[model samples]
Structures are given as structure tokens and as C-alpha cells.
Target: MPTLRQQLFRIKPVPRQKEDVETDLKRTIGLFSLTMVGVGSTIGTGIFFILSESVPVAGPAVIWSFVIAGAVAGLAVICYAELAGSVPVSGSSYSYAYATLGELPAMGVAACLLLEYGVAGAAVAVGWSQYVNQLLFNLFGFQIPHALAYAPEEGGIVNLPAILLLAMCCFLLVRGTGESIVVNAIMVCLKIGVLIFFICVGVTGWDSNNFADFAPFGISGVVAGSGLIFFSYVGMDAVATAGDETKNPKKTMPRALIAALIIVTSVYVLVAVAALSAQPWEKFDGQTAGLSAILENIVGSQWPGTVVAAGAVISIFSVTLVSIYGQSRILFTMAGDGMMPKLFREVNPRTLTPVKGTIVVSAVIAVLAGFIPLNFLAEMTSIGTLVAFVVVSLAVIILRVREPNLERGFKVPFYPVLPVVSIIGCFWIISSLQIITIVVFIIWTAFILGLYFIFGRKSSVLGKQLAEAGPTNPESARTDSTGGAK
Candidate 1:
């Protein structure tokens, strides 16, 4: 038997088979559909409501926060592209770390991914609830009561609309990925137009005075704000998580990742700039339906607010759907590796999707959305995503050194320097997060590692395969196209 340390340090083999032909997941996602997954998952949560959370911390300098967060996310996704090309599997950075770093590190990445996708889904659902209320009030002149629409911490009994939104997303995800992607694509286009409408009308109210106190909180505040706003960029990596379901993923994944990044970042900065110019940064705090409220303030009418709120209602549904989809798929990958329960990996024959896992993921996310405060959820998501991005950047370097001839369809520009910067940038933002958030993250990761020692390490399919092949030639056991033991 191999030593405990050796088992922990074992890396998964880089897949060399045809991704399209050898996977259980249907390869129906093209570049456009995949890019929409990223966009649909991202745009809904942040630009629509994050200003209320971030602008308070960085003041009008939240503009810089958006740019900083996007820049770091850009670098990380570039490295992610290379790894997705090399590993060509589901599970995003978790699988990348397994292929390059080791089993233990992969588990750590899994903990981070759970937070990145699952928590983010809940966080966005909470934002969707706020917009739902706005839409209801706009059109019907009534809204869900505070006790049912806001979290307990936010002075409400529970967030009903958020839970309802998550339930709707769960139903769609259980149906199929292809169907979900098409619906998400249509929503993406509509929301983009709605955001553009907000921008055009918002510019009309630009006072220029909002710039006078841009950096009220200085560098520390900017960094902290980036941490909160980083939650907005979480969905970009959902592209990589779809590797198993993407057609020609090697070429398609990178293109989709980059395209999604460009579109999301551009829309984010424009929305931030337009939002700040229209109102003083201080007014953003406590604004539940942020964009719609801002537009109503600027136009002095209900129609513009109603329009934006309606668009947000439509668009955020797609965000919740994609977030649940990504979370369930990551768990599916983990279960296939024997790192999680078997139910997560079981696919329904009729739907061709992991129905059980999707339902479970939705249940957990519903509880989170219904109870947790959005700011706390958002920060936790940012911290988790930052750690995952750091791992992906490091994995890029490790893979380059370990498998110099690996067949990668995409490569990071500037090589080691870019990935190194990505690592540093991610850590920088992580450092600025609230101490409590950091403490919670450490506790969560340790808990996951504990589970590994008690369960995953013993039941790992890779460990069994390695034992069968003998420690002297562990590489011979090999993993399948799905990153499970072959």
C-alpha cells in the first residue's frame, strides 16, 4: 500500500481521448450558448444590485473596484482556459487541481467550488427577490411583505421570493442542459438590452459631483469593494465547468470564456459609471432594487423603473438556473470520483441529467437564499472564488512543468508571469475581505478536509485503481474522459 502522504499527493492523469465521443454528458453547447451561460450567470447578480453593497465600501471608487475585480478575473480565466483545454473535464478548477496538483488539493478546490457556485446561486437568488418585489410593486402596486421577502438578518422572517426563484430554476435544470442553455441565451439578450436602456437614461442625470469624493475609503476600501464585487464575476468560470457538455470544448471553451469575460466586464463598468454619475454614492446603501430605483429617481416616473425591474426579473431567473446547473455538475464530477455520495453522479435516463443532484443542490441553495443575508453570501462567494482562481493559476504552472507536451487547445499569454500575477491578485482581494468571512472560509475548508480524511480518502476510486495497478506504476490505472477511474 502507498503511504498516506503519497495517496494525498497523487495527481489525476490528463485526459487524451476525444471529449465529444467518450462522455455521458451531451455535447450540445456551442461557443455562443456557452458564453451565454457565463453572461446569464453573472450579469444578473452584480450590476443589478451589487452597487448597494459595494458602493458603500469604496464610495464612487467602486468604479475602480469593478475594474480591479474584472482584471484579476480576466487573468484567472485566461489560465482557466489553458487548464480546461488540458484537462477537458467537468468540475472546473477542482478537476484542474486534481490533474496538476494532487488529490488533497483537489478536495480543497472542491470546497471552494461549492461556495463559488452554490453560495453564489443563493446570493443571486436573494438579489432576484429584491427585484421581484420591485416589479410587483411597479405593475400591480403591491409587493410581498417584508417578513416574507427579506432574510431574518435583514429584518424579515424569510425570503420567499428568493426561494421561489430557486425552485423555478431547479425545475428547469432537471429538464435538461440544452433546454436551460437556450432559455438562458434568450434571457441574456433581453437583459443586455434592458441594461443598455438603463445606461442611456442614467447618463441623462449625470451630475459630475459624484466624482468629488471618489476614493473616500482609499486603497483599503477599493480592495474591500473588489472583494464584494468579485462575486459578480463568479459565473465566468461556469464555462469551464461545462467542459463535459461542450462540443469541441478545447476550442469552444476558451473562446466562450473570453467572450463572456469581455461582455460581462464591459457591461459592469458601464453600469457602474452610469449608476454613480446619476446619484451620489451614499444614496446607494439600503436600496433594495438598486437599478430600478436609480432609474425611477432619474426619470421621475414609474415606467422606466418598471421596465428595468421586469427585465431583471426575467434575467435573474437565468442566473439562478445556470448557477444551480454549475453546482450540480461539479457535484456530479466529484461523486463520479467517489469523493462525494453516489447519488450526485447518477443521471436520469430520460432527462440525460443528474436529476437527484440538481434537486439536492436546489434544496440546499433554497435554504441559503431564504435565510442568509445577501452581503454575507456575496462575500463568502468572493472569498471562495478567489481561492479557486488562485488554485487554477498555480495549476497552470504545475501542468506546464509536469506535462510539457500535454495537448492543450489554449495557452495563457505571458505564461508564468500572467498566472503568477493572477495568484497575487486573487490573494490581494482575499486579504481585503472581512475577518469573519476569512474565519468562516478557513473553518469550512478544514471541515471539508476532515471529511476527506474520514470518508473521501478511504473511498476514493482513484486510490482503489492505483492500488490495483500497484504503487510502482500508478499512472497505468488512468482516468476516463470524465476524470473518474477507467
Candidate 2:
């Protein structure tokens, strides 16, 4: 049996020295394409669908909720950028944690991120089902049978449309990233334009009466609303996940992170304020395709609503694709570390993408999107993301302390204080979540950690290489590990 010390920690250093472990992924993504990846994934389901659900909890105070969530997301991204710029690896916070905190905790971070990306992707696909149905219903005056569109809890036998959507994204990803993110970039532009249109028309319907009871549920509501709305900002870290495929990670990663942060935050705040102004907050409670519903109610015509619904249907598909893409990359890196099946690490020689990993990820996500209740997925996503952000913040501090001279293109402005604040902010929001989300997250993380101790520690490629290398340098170890192969 391994000692407790051995069982709980395995640190992964920067692997550029290891030729055998080099992922060999093509670095074809430039800044604009990378930024669009962030924008594409960040703007999905949350803003498209979270508003109506959040309004009842927050009233017009929901406006503050969007801002609060954006603030925390912004803080967390700073820590992620520092780590991404310094380490420039593929697994995101999962890689960051292994660099700074060691492998046991890296696996823990991996577990949180796996939940964050998977549940969020599933949630987006489920959200996409609603808009797709709305689009079809608007154009033809006929809807698919509910049994084929939603989960059992939502009064359907299975969410078949959502499953089909996930499968479509999987196919696109296997085809390659260049084609995928180009389509995503165009979708990002289209979705933002549609949201701007929402703002334009919604402003005309503003009523002072809606502001009268803005805090009906009080400050508690604002905090609680932030927790719910935080899900909207989940995908910003995905930019960091592209570190390996990015051109000039030191410059491009931070630029894309800040740009996507500003774009997603501004767009979300604008959408929330417009939707709140367009209709009474109470009316938001059950407004399915709520943003479109606001436009229809305002114009007393279905055409404007149909246009918005069509944009949503077409655009959310990209969001689902981008989000799922992030999850596959993270797992791909884990496989490269020998923490998952090696087959997942195999980059397709033709496409330079992890086709096997994408297929496996899409299959698992399809089941979640098709059968699980959407609300459960949303809350679990928010909670797991909070934990992952906390890990990233802590990783920044640990990395700085352990390797002060590490080259960093973008060091966080305030250093230790800001990282601590990032950590505190994540926990504060986490505290406001309902009991069930907290419980489910606890159960899920515990199970993942358990699996790590039982199987992962013995299998880590970096750990085995280091064991064999003793105190020798990484270059010598690399020669032996790969027999000097390119």
C-alpha cells in the first residue's frame, strides 16, 4: 500500500521537456478566433435562458445580480490568465492545480471542472431545445411532441432534440477546430446582434412602475440572484483551455480573456436591464423564451419575437459546441498525463484534434442533456464552477510562492490580496446556494477523489517519469522516456 503522503500528491511540472508527452496539437488559433471561442461559449444558455428564472428571485434587483456575477467572474479570470500565461498548458485549472498544488488536488480540480463544463454543456443543449422548439413553433405554427423535446421531469419522455444537438456538435468537432470556431465566431456575432436588438426594442417599453419594488426579496435576493446568474459566466476559463492550440500563449491568452470578459459582461448586463424594463418583473416568472416573449408582448406582433427566437435557435447550437469543445480538451490533457485512457490523447494525424476524446465526451453529455432535469443541471453547474474558480485562485497563490521566477506575461495586478479576494468571493456565492446543490456537489467530488486514490495515483505518467529520473534534469529524462524521438 502507498503511504498517505504518496497517495495524496503528484505534481506535474511544465512538460515541454518531455518529447514523448508533447501533445503535438497544431497551434493554429489566433487571438480573434480564440476570443470568439470565449465569447461563443460564455454568451450561451445563461443569458439566453437564465434571465426569466432569475427575475422572480431578484425582481429588478436582477440587474445587480448580473453585475455581481460578472464581477466575480472577472476576478477569477485574472487568476486564470496569470496561470495560463505563465504555464501555457492545455488542461485549464486542472493543469494549473497540478502545476501548483500537486496531482491529488489536480484531480479534484479536474473533477470540479469536469462537472462545470459537462453540466454547463448539457444545460446549454437543454436550453437549445427550448429555442429550437420555439423557432419551429413560430414559423410553422406546429411544435414537436413534448415527449420528444423534454426530460421526464419536464413532462417529456426524453429530450431527444437536445441529444440530437449534442451529436451534431460532436460531428463538427471531429471534423476540426478551425472550422468549428469560425462558425462559432459568426454565431457569436449573430447572437450579440440579436441581443442588441432586444435592448433596442425593450427600452421603449420601460415603465417606472416596474422599479417600485425592485428589491422585493431584499439584499438576500441580490446575493441569491448572483449565485444563479453566475452560471452565465461559466465559459470564460475555456480560453485558457486553448493554451496549447493558441498562437503565442503569453500574449494571446490574456488578451482573449480580458476581451471576452468585457464583451460577455457588457452584453449580459444590457440584456438583463432591457428585459426587466420591457415587462413587469413578476411576469418574468414563467416566460419561456423570455427575451423573445418580452419583444412579442411589447410589439403586440409575433414577427419580432420570431426573429429573436430564430437567432437563438441558430446561435445556441454554437454555444453548445464551444462549451463541449472545452470539456474535451481538458480530458485530452488528462489522458496525456496518463490519468485517463491513452486513446483519448491520440490527436488525429489528419485533423490534429482529439477525435476519440470528443466522441466520448459528447456521448456522456448527450445522456445528461437528454434525461436530467435542466434546473438540477444549472444549480450543479454553478456550484461546481464556484469550486473550480476557488481552486484556480488558490493555484495562483501556490504557483507564485513555489516558483516566484516563473515567466509570466500577465501577473495579476494586486497579487496575493486579489487572489484571496477571488477565493473569498467564490465561497460567499457558494454559501447562498440551496442545500440540494451543495449536497449533490459534495457527493460528486467525493466520488471523484475516491476514484483518484484507488487508481489515478499509480498511473500518472509524470509521477512515473519523475520516479525513474531521481534528481536528474528533465532533458535527460526526456531522452530516456522517448529514446530521443522527435
Candidate 3:
């Protein structure tokens, strides 16, 4: 029998069993729809209000913050592309760590992803409530009462709209991935069009003065702003999360990731610049519905604002849906690996989807969205995503060193250097976050690790597989060892 240290550090083989894989998730996502998933998830609610958070710090140079954050995201995603091509699994960074780092590390990555997807779903839903009310009042001159529309911290009883949004998303997800992708694609197009409308109209009122105070806080300010704006880039990894369901994930995953990054980054930069040129960066401080407000101020009318609000309502629903979709799949992957309960891995025959997982995920996030204030959720998400990115970058380097001959459809350019820079960039942004956010993240991760010690280590499926294979079956046992390439 292997010692405790060896068992904890054992790796899951890259090769999967036929029975283990054949009847699980279906491969219905193509490159285009996968790209739409990434775009839909990333561009939500952030652009609608991010300027208010980032602009005061960096002034007009908040534009550079967008680029910096995008660069970090792109580098990390490139690493993800390489790993997704190599592993082609569903757990995103978690599975990558299991294949390269070890079981304990994989669980660590899972801790971060739970925050990234599950909490982010709730957080994004909470933001969606505001836009839903805005759209309602804009169209019908009626709005959900504050008591029903906000969490207690926001001076409301419960965020009913957020819970309602989560319910709608859960219903669609339980139906099937194909249908969800189609709806998300439509929303992506509609929201992109709305942003373009804002850009075209806002540029008409361009004032040169906005650029005068550019870099008012210098590079330090730009970096700080990048840290804040990093939240917008969180969803790109959701594309990689679809590896198991993606058609030709090796090619499709990388193509969709790069395409989504280009599209999201371009849209973010253009919107930031247009909004900046139309008004002084100083005015962005404490602004709500930043994009819609900018359009209204530029055009001297409420109609453009109304149009943006409606688009936000439609677009943010897609974000919440994709977030919930991602959370369920990650849980499904974990359950399949025996890290979570089997109910999460149970597929519904009618839909070939993890129906129970989706419902459970939606219910948990619904409670959070309804009862918790999301004022800190954005920062928490950024930290979680950044930490996960750091691990992906490390996994790329480790896999390259260990599996030198392993086949990869996509490889990170500049090899180890790019991955290292990606790690450094992630840490650079991480250091700029509030001390309290970092402390809270550490506490949350500790709590998860505690669970791992209590239950996961005892029940791990990979550990059991290795133990049953034993020393007598040398080939199978070797295949299960850490950093072992097949």
C-alpha cells in the first residue's frame, strides 16, 4: 500500500475509461457557440458599471487598465488552451492540477473555482436585479419595490428579481446545453449591438478635455484600476470549462478562447474610450449604470439610456445563465471524480444534462443572490479567478517539464516565460486588492481545505482507483503516479 503522502499526491491518469466517459455530457458545443458563451459571460454588467469603479483611480488612463487586464487574461487563457488541448476534461483548472500538480492541489484549485463560478453567479444575478428594475421602469413606468429587489444590506427584504433570474436560468440549463448556447448567442449579439450604439452616439459629443488628465495617478493608478477592472475578464475560462462538451476541444477551445478575448477586449476598450471622450473621468465617480448614463448625458435624451437599459436586462440574464451553467458542470466534473456527491454527476436521460446538479447549484446561488449583498462579490471573484489563473500557468509549466512528449493542439507562445509572466501579472493585480478581500479569500480557502481533509481525502475516486490497481498491476499503478505521462 502507498503511504499517506504518496496517496495525497497521486495523479489521475490522462486516459479515461470508456464506461467512465461515454454516457456523461454530450459534445454539442462548437467553436462559435463556445465563443458566444465566453463573450456572453464576460461582457455582462461589468461594462455597465465598471467605469464607476475604475475611472476615479486611473482617470482617463483607465483605458490602459482594460488593456493590462486583458493582457493578463489572454496570457492565462493561452496557458489554459494548452492544458485544455492536452487534458480535454471538464473541470477546468481543477482537472489540470489533478493531472499535473496532485490531488491536494486539484482540490485547492476547486476551492478557487467554487468562488469563481458559484459565488459569481449569485453576484452577477444581484447586479442583474438593478438593470431589470431599470428596464421595467423605463418601459412601463413601474418597478419592483426596493423591499423585493434588494438584499438586506441594501435596505431591502430580499432580492426577488435575482432569485427569479436564477430560476429562469436554471430552467434553461436543465433543458440542455444546445438550447442554452443558442439563447446566450442571441443575447451576446444584442448586447454587442447596444454597446456599438452607445459608442456611435457618445463619440458625437467628444470633448478633448477628458484626455488632458490622463494618467493623473500614473502607472500605479493604471495598475490599481486594472485590478478593479479584472472582474470583467473572469468569464473567459468558462470556455475551457466546456471542454468535455466541446466538439474537437483541442481546436475549438483555443479558437473560441482567443476569439472571445479579442471581441471582449475590443468592446471594453472602445466603450471605455467613448465614454471617457464624451465626459470627464471625474464624473464617473459614484455613477450608477455608467454606460447608460453616459449615453443619456451625450445625447441629452432618455431614449438612448432606455435602449441600453433594455439591452443590459437581456444581456445580464445570459451572464447569469452561463455562470450557473459553468458552476453545474464543474460540480458535475468533481462528482465524476468522486470529490462531490454522485447526485451532481447524475445525468438526466431526457436531456443528457446534469439536471440535479443544475437545480442544486441554482438553489444555493439563489439563496445567496436573494439574501446576500454583493458589494464585495466582484473583488472576491477577481481574487478567486486570479488565483486559479496562477495555477493554470503553473500547470502549463509543470506539464511541459514532465510531459515533454505529450501532444498538445495549442501551446503557449514563448514557452515557460509567458507562463511565468502570466503568474507574475496575476500576483501583481492580486497585491492591489484590499487587505480585507485577501483575508476573506484566505479564510474561505482554509474552510474548503478543511472539508477536503475531513471528507474528500477519504472518499477520493482517484485514490481508490490507484489502491485497487495496486503494485501487482505495475502498468496501471505507474499510470496513476504524479507527473506520469502516458
Clashes of each: 0, 1, 0
> Alpha carbon lDDT of residue 101, candidate 3?
85
- Backbone clashes in model 3: 0
lDDT of 2 by residue, 57-93 (tens): 9899999998998989899999888887787767888
Ranking by TM-score: 3, 1, 2
Which candidate model has the greater TM-score, 2 or 3?
3
Best by TM-score: 3
Q: Model 2, which residues run further than 4 Å from truth?
A: 1-4, 15-22, 212-217, 471-486
- Structural RMSD, model 1: 2.1
Q: Which digits, one per residue and each the tens of the lDDT, describe model 1 over residues 129-189? A: 8888877877888989999999999999999999988888888888998898999999999
Please give the distance, in angstroms, between residue 141's alpha carbon in candidate 3 and its true position after superposition. 1.5
- Best-fitting candidate, measured by lDDT? 1
Question: For residues 233-264, what per-residue lDDT tens digits would candidate 3 score against the true structure?
Answer: 88888987887788877778888888999999
C-alpha RMSD values across all candidates: 2.1, 2.9, 2.6
Per-model CA lDDT versus the true structure: 0.88, 0.82, 0.86
- The local lDDT score (0 to 100) that residue 330 gets in candidate 2 is 88
Kindly give the stretch of ten consecutive residues in candidate 3 with the minimal lDDT sum: 477-486
Q: Model 3 segments beyond 4 Å from truth?
A: 16-23, 472-474, 477-486
